[model samples]
Target: MLTHFERSLVEALRPLPDHRLTAIVEVARLSPPERREVFDKFGNAGYPILYQEHFANLRDIGPWLFCSGKYTSLQGQYNFHHGLSKATGDTPISWLTSALEPSRLARHLGEAATASGPDGSTHLLRFYNEQAFPILHSRQDLPGIDHLLVPIHSWWLRDAELDRDDGEKGWRRYEGKDRADCCGVPPIHLDQACWDALTGDGSSQRLADLLGSLPGAPAIESYYPNWLAQVRSLLAKGRRLGLKQQADLDEFVLFLSLHANPLRGSAKLEAAFNAAFKDAVDGNQPLAQALKQRLPPRLLTSQSNV
Candidate 1:
C-alpha cells in the first residue's frame, strides 16, 4: 500500500489548477533533484519519482524515481518499448519482457547497424509481424525525468519518405526542376512527421486498429488489460468532475494521490492510485491545497444502501 509521503503527494494533486497544470510542463523542464523534490513529498514509502518525455513523438522516455534509487540501465531496456506498449498495445512484437531478452537485442544489432543514415545515426527497425516498421527519433537528456540515458525510438519511420516540394527557381535549384525533383528523403525533424503519420493529420486509423487487436496476443500479460481498463474507468469518473481530456489523468491521479494517505481514504485504492500518479504529481503547493478540498469524506462501507 501507499506510505505516508506518497499519500501526501496524491492529496496535493487532486484538485489541480489549469495554471498550475501548465506549470507542470515548466517544472518538467527543471533540474532532476528539483523536479523529483516535487514528487518526493507525495510518494508512499516506496513511491518513486519519475519524469517522462516523448521522442520522435512516438515513445515516452522516462527517468523514473522509485524507492531504491534511479537506474538508467533498466530504463534503457524499457524506454521505447514501454511507451509504445502503453500508447499502442502490449503484444509479443512490443512486449516488455521480449525486448528485455538479451537475444532480441543481439539478433537485431546487425540490422540496426546496416540501417545507419548519412548522419552516422543508426536506425532501429523493429519488425512486428512482417509489414510494419519502427524507427529512432532523436537523442537528448531531459533532467527532470529520470537521469535517463536511453535514446527514444519509434516504430513507424520504416516506410516514411520525404518529397521535396516545388523548389523556387534559383541557383540553388539543380537545372530544370519540377515537382519531379521531389523524391525520397527523410526529414531531419523525423519526430513530427512520425507523429503525424501515426496520430495526427495523416494519421492511420488502420494502425490504431491493428494495435488494438494486439492486447491479448501471445506473450502479453493478462493484468495489463485489466490495468488499462481500471485506468479508463477512473478516468471516466474524473470526466464527470470536469476532466475530459488525456491531461485529465493528471488531475484524477492528483485527487487520488492526496487522499492516498490513510488519513483520507481507502488504503487499497490509495495504494493503487499512487502506482498510477507517480511523477505526474510534482508535490506543488497548489496540488496540496486541491486535495484538501476535493477528497471525499471518509466513510465505512457496509453496503449500507443495499
Candidate 2:
C-alpha cells in the first residue's frame, strides 16, 4: 500500500548491487508494525543515508553526510550525538526524524557552512540510502561509480606501559622508553596553518600530509565562537557575573553590534545551540533566569523571537 513516491523509491532500490541492498536490509530490519509507522511518517519525503569519512588519521572528526546529492552542503555533517549513535549502533527513529526534518536540516546546514574553517570547505561525501539510492542509481549519467555505499571504520592506538619482545619474527613490543604509545594525546597543538588546512579547501589532502608527519592518530575538536561559549556558560552556571562572565557578555554584545540583523543571527545561534540550552535549563530555574538576563530585551519581549 505504498504511495506513488514510496513506490518509486522502492523501485529505484530494487536494482541495487546485492551487497549494498544487503546492508540496507540489515540496518532496516524493522517489525511489520514498525515498518508501517516508518512508511506512514516518511512516505512523502526522502531519507538521508548518513556517511562519514576521515581526513588523514584524525579518526571520526571528519565531515559527514545527511543525504546523497551532488551538491550536499557542509552543514549536512552529522551532529555529534548522531555520529556517536551511528558509531555505537544505537540509532533510533527519533534521531532519523530530527535529521530528516526539513527545517532542522536547513538550520544545521546554515550553521555548519557559516562556521566552516578558513578555506571554506563545506563539501561532504555523498552516499545512497533507501530513499536516495534508487533515484541516483537510476541515472545512467551518474559521475562516479565508487560513490556508492563504501563503509569506513576508524581506530585509535593506545599507549602500553610494558614492552614485550617476543621471539617471533615481526612480533616485538617496546616497553618503557622503548615502548611508544600508538595513540597520543589529542591534537590540541594544531598551528594556525594546520587549522586553516583542516577547515579550508582540499582538507583531505592537507590532513593526509599532516597525519603522515604525526606519530599517532590526531584527535580533532570542534571550534565555537567566544560569544556563543559565553552565552552557553551563562545558561549553564546561572547568573554568576564574574569578571570573565562580564567579558563574555561584553563580547556577546559586540557580536550583536556587528551583525546587520541581530535578531536573525540570534535566532540562528539559538537553533545551533538548542540542545545545550535545553540541557542547561532542564529543571533549573536559576539557569533559565540567568539565560533570560543575558538575552537582549528585544528578544525577551518579541513574540517573533520564538
Best by TM-score: 1
- What TM-score should be assigned to candidate 1? 0.17
Tell me the alpha-carbon RMSD of every candidate.
24.9, 22.7
Q: How much is the lDDT of residue 45 in candidate 2?
A: 34
Per-model TM-score, in order, reads: 0.17, 0.16
After superposition, candidate 2 runs with Cα above 4 Å error? 1-88, 91-104, 107-116, 119-306
Candidate 2: C-alpha lDDT:
0.27
lDDT of 1 by residue, 209-300 (tens): 32234434323243233223223334433433333334434345334322334535466555444443332344332322343333343411
Residue 285 in model 1: lDDT:
29
Worst 10 residues of 1 by lDDT: 17-26
Pairs clashing in candidate 2? Answer: 119-200, 163-174, 163-175, 174-179
C-alpha lDDT of all candidate models, in order = 0.26, 0.27
> Over the stretch 136-187, how does candidate 2's per-residue lDDT look in tens digits?
2222122231122112111011111111244211111111111111111111
